[model samples]
Target: MINMGVSFKIPNEYGNHLSDILEPLPFNYYQWLINNDEIHIVHDNEFTNQFLFDEDKIISGEKLYEKSKNNTYYMVFVTLRAFLKDGTIKSVSKYKEFTESDCQIILAVYDCSYVIFWCKNSQLVSKMYMYALSKGYEDIKYITEEELIKNKYYIE
Candidate 1:
C-alpha cells in the first residue's frame, strides 16, 4: 500500500479549525492551504463534496467515529480511481468525458472532522456533539436507531 503523504489541506472555508483534529500529524498541508489560493473553499468544495463524495463512496461521520474512537486522529481519505486508457493512468470513464492525454486520476476524498472533536471534548463536548448531530439526517439517523445499531457508519 502506498501511504500518500497528506501534504495538503481542505481549504479554509471547509474550516481551518483543525488543531482539534490534526494536532498529532505533522500537517504540512495546513500551511500549504494558508498560502495557496488555488486550494480555496470553492476548490475544496468541488474536490471534496462534489468529486470525492459523489464520485467515490466514502464512509464518514459515525462509521469513522467507530473506526478510530480510541485513537485521536483525523484524516481526509482520497482515492484516485483512474486507470490507463492507452498507456497511462488517464483513462476516460463511462461516467465522465475526457479528451486529455495526461494521466487521468479520479480522486475521491472524505473529510473526517468528527474524530478530532471526540478526542478534545471527551464527554463534556456538547458543542462538538452538536456538530456531529448536524452532519446527519435527523429522521434517518435518530438516537434510538443508533442505539439499536450500536455502530457508527455513514455513507454519502
Candidate 2:
C-alpha cells in the first residue's frame, strides 16, 4: 500500500542542491526529468492562482496547462519505506521541485502507513534532509528517472 502526503512548494535557496545528495548526476536535474521516458503525464498545468492567501498554497489552473505544454521545468522527488510484518518501522523520504507562481521552492513528506502527507515550501525539507544525513542516514538512496516513472506516486 502507498501512503500519500500533501505536496508543498519550497524556495530554491533553502535546500542543499540535489547535486549535494548525489553527485556526477547524469545530466543536471532539469535535464534528467525532461529526458526521462516513463514519466506518466497525469496532471500538468500552472499552479499559480490556487491560493487565496500565502498560507493557502494551492496550484492554479493557468500554470497547470503551461506545465503540460512545456514539459520542461517541473521536477519531482519521492521516497518509499518498507516495513517488516512484525511491526518494525521502515521509511524513506523522496523529494522533488517544480516552478510555481509566487513560490520558487517546494518540499514534501509522505508517511505511508498513516496516510499522512505534510508539505511546506520553506527551506525546512532540505534542512531536514541534511540533518538526517548528518544523523547517520548514510544509506539514503537517490532514485533515478527510470525508477520515478515506474512508481509515479501522486497526491490525490
Candidate 3:
C-alpha cells in the first residue's frame, strides 16, 4: 500500500494564518460537495460536537471542510485504519499516542501548523503532487510515504 502526502512552507505572501495550510487541498483533492463518498472527515477536535468522538465520523466531508478550514488550530484524525498480517483488521479501541517511527500509521500534529495532504489513490496522488508543484509555491516539498513514516522532512 502507498500513502501520498506533501509538506510546504506557507509563504507570508500566501497568508500565514491557519487557513493558509489548506491552500493545497483545493479542487485536486475532490470537490467540497455532498455527492463524493471517496472522502470522509473521520475526526476533528470539536469536543462539543459528538461526531468528533465517533469511531466513524461519517459527517459529510463538505460540511466539515467548510466548518474547519479556517480555524486557527484543530486536530484531525484522518482515518485510523491499519492492516494486520493476514490481511485482517487491527484497529485501536481508543486513540493512542503515535510515534514517528511507528510503521503504517498516519499521524498529523496540529500544534505545528501543518496539515497532511494525504491520499491512497495513486492517480489522485500524482495529480495533487503535480498540481502543488505547478503552483510554484516556495519551499514546497514532497514527502514520500517512507519519509513521512520515518519523519525525515522538516516543514519549517
Candidate 4:
C-alpha cells in the first residue's frame, strides 16, 4: 500500500543541482541522479504556472518552454534503506531505459525507503507511481513542497 505522507515540492534552487546542496545523505544517493534531459518536459500547460513560480524569472509560458527545452526537471524519492540487488551500499549513478523521448518526469526511489518524484507532467507522475507499485514498492510516502522548503532551512 502507498503511504501518503506530507507532499512537498523540491525548491527551485535545488532543481537540477540536487547533488550540490544535499549533504550527509544516504549512500544510495547516486540512484537519484538523472542526466536524461529528455525526461524533464512539462506536458500540461496549465500547471506550467507552478513551474513559473519555481523559476521565479519566467514571465511567460513561451519563455518557460524555451528555457526548459534543453533541460529536464526531475522529482526524486529517497528511501531509508538500500534496494540494491547485492545488499551492498555504494554511491553510483544508473541510467534509466529511454523508452520514449516524451517522458518529462522522473520518480527517484532512494534507498528503497524514501521516494522523490519530480516532473511537470502529471500523467508521467502517475505512471511513475504505478511503475513503483509494479516493482513491489509499497512503503512510499509523499513529501510536501512546503516540507522540502522547511527541511532546507532545517538546522540540526
State which candidate has the highest lDDT: 3
Tens-digit lDDT string for candidate 1 (12-65): 234333333332322221111011012122242344332212321233233222
Give a tens-digit lDDT track for model 2, residues 51-156: 2122312223233233334432222332222122232232223333221112222223222111112223223334444444553433333323344334454322
Model 2: per-residue Cα lDDT at residue 104:
21
Measured with C-alpha atoms, the lDDT of residue 88 in candidate 1 is 39
What does candidate 2 score on TM?
0.23
Clashing pairs in 3: none
| Error in Å for residue 10 of model 3 | 2.2
10 residues in a row with least lDDT, candidate 3: 31-40
| Candidate 1, superposed: residue stretches over 4 Å from native | 1-15, 20-109, 112-123, 130-149, 154-156
Clashes of 2: 24
Residue 78 of model 2: what lDDT?
29
Error of 4 at 34 (Å): 4.8
Rank order by TM-score, top first? 3, 4, 2, 1
Please name the candidate that would achieve the greatest TM-score relative to the true structure: 3
**Alpha-carbon shift of residue 98 in model 2 (angstroms):** 5.1
Alpha-carbon RMSD of each model: 16.2, 16.9, 10.2, 17.2
**Candidate 4, residues 106-139: lDDT per residue as tens digits?**
3343321344544433444455455555545445
